[model samples]
Target chain A: MIPVITAFDRSPDGGKGLARDTRVRWALEEAGQSCDVRPVSFASLRQPAHLALNPFGQIPTYEEDDLVLFETGAIVLHIAERHNGLLPVDAAARARAIAWMFAALNTVEPPILERQTAVLLESDKPWTAERLRSIDQRIDVRLGQLSARLGDDEWLDGGFSAGDLMMVSVLLRLGSSGLLDKHPGLAAYLARGEARPAYRRAFEAQRTFNTRPGPSE
Target chain B: MIPVITAFDRSPDGGKGLARDTRVRWALEEAGQSCDVRPVSFASLRQPAHLALNPFGQIPTYEEDDLVLFETGAIVLHIAERHNGLLPVDAAARARAIAWMFAALNTVEPPILERQTAVLLESDKPWTAERLRSIDQRIDVRLGQLSARLGDDEWLDGGFSAGDLMMVSVLLRLGSSGLLDKHPGLAAYLARGEARPAYRRAFEAQRTFNTRPGPSE
Candidate 1:
């Protein structure tokens, strides 16, 4: 059965493919699966119907038959577990790959999201500049450690598992931050992830969906 | 073979069971499994040997034979997948449980961690009070939503699966913050989690480990 996933009616990023649905789309494309996208407006996200699907009232919820799931990481993991392409077949490699997925979300992404909070919510505050400097230092520390670990590797673990998919998606949020510039290797790594055929397809699909004229437009 | 997990030689939280290792230990106790803990000093966390286990250089990392895994969420998940008690047997239920796990780490924990950063890294800054108020509001939003969803339920989903283990662990960080007090239902929920026999065993073990007299002491 084709899964149906929820995305934003109009993405805040305006078709930049930064909306989390793109991550699920990328995973679907990589796993050789197709899914239908359901758009939820900003107002409806907090409504009862949506909250029933996800308590957090976030986007990119996955529904397949009787099962309903949210949290982009969990949804991607569901896809990876069912399909062959997103995770390695080897027992140890698969577990290690799953570790990377957790590391990306738990270890690396927190500081990045903090930066986003500082930008989106606290930008008007007087201490924004100094706070941002501190936040960026924290981000750079993680980036430097990540770059050191990546070194000359093509992927975080092995050949492009769900781990890389998550790490790259998290890193893409930093595109405008200029932090990636400090780590040329990670920048190239992000480029490599974007260059994937699956990623390209997923990006174009969201871009078109997000950019297309609405009824009012 | 027993899995060996890495933890702090001297936990910053002392013996309060707030360390990530407590999460792993709770999972092991829930699974009725026993494992060895190897304590790593703060200075050694960045060293090559520790970095080899976890590129991010955080604990607790799980190593069973040839497989080495990091990220507390991943470690708890590893224990869950290998044992029967932590995850529901039904496929859909299992997926939803995993969603809660991700929600705990990604959605719920990030804002809490941000509050930590503000206190730990920016405590002396002039705008700390203003920033903390903003951070607290963000945290309260999540807490309110979580309280509404949790309602009077004993667990986030159904039975006390790994999802509960994770959610409880994340909420435990807020114990001293007094944020949970705003939601009595959620506060009781956390107390219920701490009252679990498995959790008691895990907590006592870590408390003993952390409070033991060191050679210098």
Candidate 2:
């Protein structure tokens, strides 16, 4: 089976590839693996069948043969581990790559998500400005540490791996915040990941999905 | 060569096993691996020596022979991948277990961390209560989903794997929030994980490091 998964019925990003599914799609495309998409509304996602695939009722659960997987990090890692391109062959390098993946999701992404929640949900709150500033500062600290470590390097570790893929995905969330431009090297690094053909393909694919006419439309 | 890493000279948790180092210690104990602990003061963590091992200046980096890995998920996964007890034998089952690991950190822990930050940094902000409520709701949603999926099951996915180890570590952060109590099942689940002998050993080890009198004390 060509592993099928869900995508936003319509992405909040206005068809941008910022959706989590886009990352998995990009990984599959990069690996030359064919896959399928199942567009789901927020309502449909809560239904029993979708929840069965993803307990979190989130997007991009991968299904292949007897294996079913959720959590984009795990799915992407699965692809990276099974295929050759996304992970390094050397054991130490591979471990570091996985470490970066965890760091991206676990460490870097948290503040970004907080910033997003602040923007999307709490914009009208009295302390929105203060909360936004604090969250952004946290992002800046993490980015500063990451930028210092990455200094003048093309990717996180050695060659591009799932680590870079995940880091770029997390960093892309900073698009509107404009905080990324504060560090020219990190900005360039994000651009480099976006420049990948696989990323472009994934972007367009999600864009197409988002733009597709809904039943009412 | 055995791996040794630093702990807080004086833990913010005051030897309650809430420090990040405890997770690493627990994984080590579960793997039945003997390791050394080198306690470091807050002043020392940012110094060049520690930064060389962990660029992010965070806890639980692993050092074994030529390899040094950061990110607790990476370190725990490394131990799980190498050792027998932490992971499973079958391929698909192993992948699912890994998915739970990602879900715990990426999905579950982020909101809890936000709650911590709100209390630590943003508690005085006018919107603190609202911000906290939103973060708590997000956490509760994840827990509700996880608890429903878990549905009286013992461990996530299957017999205790590294995934459970990680999930428990992440859930432990909610100790102060009293959010876990919202779901009796998850509360019980955490209690069971804490009951493990290895977890107790790991807790005591880190407690020893945490409680040991520092020069400042």
Candidate 3:
């Protein structure tokens, strides 16, 4: 059965591929899997129907057979577990890769998301400029540590795995912030991830879906 | 071989069990697994030795045999996958449980962590009070959605799994915040988690470890 995943009907990013569905799509592309995308309107996201699939009422939920899963990390993991390309076959290496996934979402993404909250939610506040500075400093610390760890390596560990996929996706959020340019190695790292065939395919698919004209148009 | 996990020599919370290591301890207790805890001082966290294990320079790195793992979510998940207690036997149910784990760390904890950043790091800022109010509102939206989904259910899903362990751990961070009081169901859910025998054992172990007198004293 082709799995079904949800995406925003009209993404807030306007085709920037940062709405998280892109992560799932990239994972699926890497795994050589096909899925059906169901665009969910912002109004429907909070309704009982959507909330039944995900309590938090967020998009990019996955449904295959009888299983319904939410959380991009979990959904991508579900795909990676079922398919072969996304995770290493070795046990220890696979665990390490999973650790990076958590580190991306739990450790790395939190500060970046804080920056988002500051920019998107509290942009008009008097302290926005100061808060942005603090948030960026925190993001730089993580990026520095990540650059140190990735020194002279192609991927985070051995070859590209779900860990790098997640870390790259998280760092992609910094595309407009100019933070990636500060760490040349990380910028190159992000570039390598973006240059992946699977990533390109995923990005193009989301771009087409997001930019397509609506019924009114 | 027995696993060794790193933890704070002196937890900033002073045995309140808010440290990420407590989540690992709780997972270990549930799995009926015992691990040796190595005390890592704040001064040593950023040193080369610690960074070798975790580039993020954070405590609670798990080492067993040749494998070294960081990230509390990953460690707890490794334990859950190996042990029989923390995940469901059914494949679909297992995926859902894992989704809750991501939800706890990624969705719920980020705002709560922002609250931490505000209180702990930005307390002296002029906008501290206003920023906190904004952060609290974001946290409440998540808590409200979680409570609605939980309803009268005993756990987030079926029998208490790692998902509950993680969600409870995330919610415990709000103990002194009094936000849990606003959602009675979530508060009761948290109490249920703490009331578990495994949770009690985990709490006591950390409490004793953190309260122990140093040799110099």
Best by lDDT: 3
How well does each candidate reproduce the native contacts, as fnat? Answer: 0.93, 0.90, 0.95
Point out where model 3 deviates above 4 Å. Answer: B215-217
Ranking by lDDT: 3, 1, 2
DockQ: which candidate is best? 3
- Regions more than 4 Å wrong, model 2: A214-217, B214-217
Write one digit per residue (lDDT tens) for candidate 1, span A1-217. Answer: 8999999998999999989999999999999999998889888999999999988899999999999999999999999999989999998899889988998898888888888988998789899898789889988999999999999999998899999999999999997889998999999999999999999999999999898786511
For candidate 2, write residues A83-137 as lDDT tens digits: 8789989999999999999999988998899888888888887788876787788
Q: Give the DockQ (C-alpha) for candidate 3.
A: 0.95
Tens digits of lDDT, candidate 1, B30-103: 99999999999998999999999988778888899999888898889989999989999999999999999999
lDDT pick, better of 2 and 3: 3
| CAPRI class of candidate 2 | high
Taking all chains together, each candidate's TM-score versus the true structure is: 0.98, 0.97, 0.99
Deviation (Å) of A5 in candidate 2? 1.9
What does TM-score give for chain A of every model?
0.98, 0.97, 0.98
lDDT of 3 by residue, B1-217 (tens): 8899998998988999988889999999999999999999998999999999999999899999999999999999999999989999999999999999999999999899899989999899999998888889989999999999999999999999999999999999997898888899999999999999999999999999989987511
- Model 3: per-residue Cα lDDT at residue A88: 96
